[model samples]
Target: MEAFFKALLGEKAFLLDNNSKMIAPTMEGKKLHNLERLLLHVHVIVEEAEGRYIMNQAMVHQLNVLRKEMYRGCFIVDNLKRQGTESNNYKGHDVSNSFILSKFNPVKRLFLSDVDIHRETDLQQVIDNLSNIMEDVNGIVVFLNNYPPLYRQPYSMHLFIEKCMFRCQMEMGRIMAFLMQKEDQGCVGVLPIVGPTFVGKSTLVANVCNDARVRNYFFQTILITAHDINSENISTLKDGAVILHQNNALDQNNERLLAIIELSGDIDVVAWNSLLSSSSYLGRVSKMIITSRSDKITKFGTTQALVLTFLPLEAYWYFFKISVFGSIDSNDHPELQSIAMEIARGLNGSFVGANVTFSFLKDNLVAQYWRRYLSSFREATQRNVSLFRESPYGLVCDCKPITQLIRGDDEFAVWGRYHACPVEENVPMITMKDVIFGRGNYEGEFDVLAWKSHIPPYNSYIVKCVIEKSK
Candidate 1:
C-alpha cells in the first residue's frame, strides 16, 4: 500500500520536475513556486497516507484515479511543449525519466500516448487541460489531508545474537515472568509473540525457550516451526529432543510441558483450531507459546499479546558487530568498523541484512574492498529500488507500515477478531461486543473489559494487555 502511494508520488515528482524545466521559465517565478509548493504538499500528504491506506481500499482507488489524471495532464503539457518543435528534440526525452522507475525497471504502462481532450479550440484545450490536471492534483492533496482512511497492511527479516538481543531483555523478562509466575495450579498459560516476518520473532522466542530458567521451569519443551504443525509433523516434533515425563502429577513427580508454536501470516484459523485442539497439547498444567506475524493469531495467547519491537540503534550496533565479526570487537578494526556502521545504518532494524550481508562479505578481509562495497550499497539505496527485497530485511523494510507498527507511533492491535468457539453447551458464545474499552478521564489512561477462561474448578480464562497508561 505504501509502495502504491510511493509510486504515485514518484510519478508526480517526475512530472513536476519535467514541468519545472519546461514551464518554469515560461510562467512567472511565483507561479512556478506555487506549483512546486503544491507538488511538495502532495508528496507529504501521500507519505502521511501510507498508514491510512491499509484499511481503506477506496482511498487507494481515488489516489490511483488522481494519479492518472495528473499523468494525463503531464502528457498534454509534453505534447504542448513539443508543438512545432523538431521531431528529434522531443521524440522521447519527455518520457525518459517519466517511465523509468528508480530501479531501472519500467512500471506497467497505464496510460496511452493518444488521448482525446476535447476543447473549443487548440490553444484553449492545452491551457484547460493543464489547469484541470493541476486542479485535480490540488483536490487530491486536499482530500488526503482532510479525510484519512485505513486498511490492513501486510508484513514479511536475520542474525544470531550471541549477547543481548537488542531491546529484547525486557521482553524476555516479561515472557519468563509469565511462564515462571506461581499461579493457579494445573492452569495452562499461552504466550504469543507477534511481529512482522523476519523481525526476529523466532530468535527472541528461541532465546527465551533456551533460557536456563525456562528450561528449568518446564519439564519438557517442544519447538514447532511454521508448516510443521500437522498431526504427522507434530507427532514427530517430540520424537527428537523432547523429554516427556512418564508419570501423572498425582505421583508428585510429573513435570509440566511447554510447546512453542512458530507461525507466519499464512496459517489459517482451521490450522490454529486443529493445533489448539490437539489432545496431547493444551492440557491442564501445560503451557503454549506461539510466534506469528498476524495479530489475529495472538488471540490464542490467553495472556497479553507480546508484540516484538525493533532494536534500538545502539543495541542493534552491538548485535550487528556480534553477528558479523563474532567476538572480533569493532575497536580492533577502526576503519573497517566505521564503514560497517555506515552500511549498517541503511539496514534499518533488519537483522536479516546484518547476517546475510556479513556472510556475503565475510570472504574479503581487505579494508579498501569493504569500503568499495559500502559505497556501492549506499549508492544503490539512493539510485535503485531496494536491493534487499529478496532478503528478509528488504522485505520488511519495503513494507513501511509494518515497520511503523513495530517501531513507529502507531499502537499495535493486541486483540480483535472475536467470535464464538465451540465449547460445552453451558459456555456462552463469546462475541466481540462482550469485549469493551473503559473510558479514561485523564490523558492516555484507559481500561478494557477482557474475557477470562477458567480451568476446572475455576473454569474461566482472563485475557490481559500490557499497555502502560500515562496516568
Candidate 2:
C-alpha cells in the first residue's frame, strides 16, 4: 500500500512522509507563512490610509479596492491551511461521515480533494494579488503624509476593528465628500443611502455623522425618523426632529444643517415634497441624507445613491476570524480554526450572529465546546431550512421568527418584533448568548439582548423571545 501511494504521489510524497514532518514544513505550510507576511504588509498600508484626516476620492477608491484584495488573500490562505490540516488527518482516519465534510457545498468540497490541483494556483494568485496591491499603494502611502492625522488613542488592531465600522470605509468616504461639497447658493443637496434590513445602514450613517470633520462642517445635525414625519403635520418636521449635534461656534444666521432621515418604507410623495419645502427654515446651503430599505428613495438623491450590502463571503470570514480569535493567534488552535470556518459559513453573513457566536466561543476555547456549538448551529440552520424553506439569515432579514434548540426537545423561539434601544435606556439582562448556549433556565416570553453596538448610535438590539417545549 505504501509503495502504491508513493508511486502515485511521486515527488509530492514528501507531504505524506511522517518522518520528514518533524524536520520540514509542507508545501501548504510554506504558502501560509508567505501569505501571512503579505497580509501584514497590506494591513499596514490600509491602516495608514485610514488614519489620514483627508484623502481625495481617487485615493479612497484605491484604498477600498486594496482592502478587498487583502481580505480575499486572507480567506484563501486560511482555507489552504485548513485543507492541509484536514488532509494530514485523513491519511490515517476515515472521516467520510464527518459532519464538517458532509456540510460542505460543492465549491467547498472541491477543496477537500486528495489531490487538489487548484490549491497551488489559488495560493499563487492570492500572493500575486497582494503583492500588486502593495505596489499600487506605495504612491498613496507617500502622499498620505500630506494630510493631517486624526488624533486617536493607541489601540490594538482587533480593538480598532471592534470599535470601528467593519467594511464601510468607501461609503463613509463618499458621504463625507458629499457633506463637505459647496452646495449651490439656494439648493439643498440630498444623498440617499439604500440597503436591506440589518445591513448596517443605520450604523454607517451614525458613524459618518459623528465624525469630527462632518460635525465641524455642519452647524446642526438632526435625525428624523418616519415617526417624526407625520402626513397631517408634514411641515412640522423641523420641530419634531431629534438634534444629534449643534455647533455653537458657527454664526446662527449662517448655520448649515445636516438632516438624516431614516425610513422603514416608501415615503408619501406629497409629504416628502412638503418636507423638502419646509427645510427652507433650516438653510439653503444645508444638506439632507435619506436612509431607507426601499430603492424608491434613490429618486430623491441629487447624486447617485450609496447602496450598502452585506460583506462578501471572504471579507466576512476574515472579520469573523478576527472577532473570534481576538488577540490570540489562530495558528495555535488549528482545530478551532476549522470549526470557526464552518460556523462562519453557517451564519450566512449575519454580522450580529458573528458577534454573538464569537463572544461565546472566545470564552470556551476547547475543541469539544467548539464542535458542540458547530453541531448545534448546523442543526438549527437545517431545521429552519426544512421548516420555513429559508435559512436563519433569510428569516432574520425578513424579521421572521427563528428557532434555537435549547436542550433536548425544548427550543427558544425568537420573535420578529425587535428594536434597538439607547444604551442609557433600560435593557434586558438576559442575552441571546445565554439562551443559545443553554447557560440558564428561563420560561415564558422575555426580551433578549441580541447585540450591543460599541460604535456611534450606541444602542442595544433587543429581540422578543419565548420558550417552547417539545421541538
Candidate 3:
C-alpha cells in the first residue's frame, strides 16, 4: 500500500485547480474498510508486520476472500455487500480512482485537511489554516513496496521504446518510406498497422507520432486500450474533436471514423483507409496511423509489412552514453563504459532498463558493481513483476493483461506474455531469470510460443515491440 501510494504521489496533483492546489480528501477509508471487513469474514487474517507489511496465510485464501467481497472492477460479478450492484463494476467512480482512493489512504491521511471529504472543496478556508493543516502533515512518503503497471510503460509505449532501442517496425515505416518518397499523399483514415500483440505495431506508429517534429501534424493521436478486441464502449473515445482510430474499432461507425479522418483534414494512404474506408466521404483525404494488439476489425486488403529487429550493440552504446552520462567521450570511466556497453548489448533492445542500469553504474561503480548487477537484475525483476501485478490490495480489483507482442512465426503476422524487458537507468547484468522475466507467461508453453512466432497465416502486416526475446 505504501509503495503504490508513493508511485501515485506525483509533483503536481491532477485533482487540483489552475493555481495547482489540491482540493479533496475523498475518504478511501470506506473502500479499505469494505475489503478488510470482507477478508475478516472469510477467515483471511491480515497481520500487520514490520513496516506495514501485510502477511496473510495464503494468496489463494486471500483470493477467495476477495471473491466474496470484491466490488466493481475486481471481478465480473458485482459485490453485493458494498453497493448493492449486480455486475462487478462500481456504479459511479471509475475503477482507477477507486484504486487510488484505496491504496493511497495511508499517506493520504497525513494530508487529510487537503482532501475535500464531502464533495465540497473550500480551498479558501483551508488556505486560511495552511500552517495548521501542514503542521501534522510533515512530508508523507511512500517507500518502494510495489510498482503499478503504469511504470511498465504502456504496451503502446513501444513507440518511444523502439526509438531508444532502434528496433522499429517496418510495416508503418515502409508506408512512411513510400509516402515520403511518392508524389501523392493518400486518403485520410485509420491506417491499420495490424500485427499480433507486442509486435511493435503500436510502438512503431507511436514513435512517428511522438517525434517532436511530426506530433502536431495530426489533429489528435490517441491509443484506445481494451480488455477484449471487440468492445462497444470504444465509441466514447471519439466523442470529442480528436482522432480515435486505434485499438478496438470493428464496432465503430463510418461517422466516428469520419469525425477523426476529417479532424486532420488530409493524411497519408494507410491512415486514410483505416479511419474511413474508400467507401466514405472524408475518408478520401489521406494520412492516418493505426496499430492494433488484436485484429478486432477487418477492412482493406493486406499489405506487406517489415519486421523490426533489435538495435546493434553499437547503437545501444551511443543511446546509453547520451541518455545517461550524456557523453561517450568520458575519459574518467573508459573501463566502466566498456563493461557497461557489453552488458547493454546483452539486454537486447531494452533501452529503458539499460538506461536504469547505467544510471546506477554512474555512481561509485566498477567491475564489482557490474558483476553484482548482472547477477541480480533478473531476480529483482521477477520479484518486481509480482509487485507490479499485485491487485489493488483489496478495496477493489480490476485486471488487464500487460500487453506484450513477441513476433511469432507469422512474419508480419498477427500476438503475450506481459512485459518485453526491464527499463532501468543502467544496464544491469542479468542471468537466466531475466530472460525468463522477458519470456513471461510463454515459458513452458512451447506451442503457444511457437504459434506466437508464426507469421505466415495472417498474410498481413506484423510489427515487433522494442525488446527482443532470444527464444
Best by lDDT: 2
User: What TM-score should be assigned to candidate 1?
Assistant: 0.43
User: Over 4 Å off in model 3, which ranges?
Assistant: 1-203, 210-217, 226-237, 240-285, 292-303, 321-325, 328-334, 363-368, 377-471
Which structure is stronger by TM-score: 2 or 3? 2
- Tens-digit lDDT track of model 2 for 1-471: 224323444543433344234423777667666676677667666766666665687877888888898888878766766766764533443333354466354323422432245777878788887787777655776777688766466555677677788887778888888999888887889999898888889899899988988888889999989987767776566777889999999887888889999999888788788788887655553788999999998998899999998887789988899888888988678878977876787677887778778677987898767766766776677677777877776688888888877866656565555678889999999988777667788888999998888898998989989888763
Per-residue CA lDDT of model 1 for 371-456, tens digit only, reads 55654454334322333233223443444211111111223212211212123424433321232112222223222222222211
Q: What is the lDDT of candidate 2?
A: 0.76
Q: lDDT: which is higher, 2 or 3?
A: 2
Kindly state the number of residue pairs that clash in model 3.
67
RMSD of each: 23.2, 7.9, 24.4
Residue 64's lDDT within candidate 3 is 27
Q: After superposition, how far is residue 67 of candidate 1 from its true place, in Å?
A: 46
What root-mean-square deviation over C-alphas does model 1 reach?
A: 23.2
- lDDT (Cα atoms) of all candidates against the true structure: 0.48, 0.76, 0.32
Best by TM-score: 2
Candidate 1 lDDT for residue 143: 56
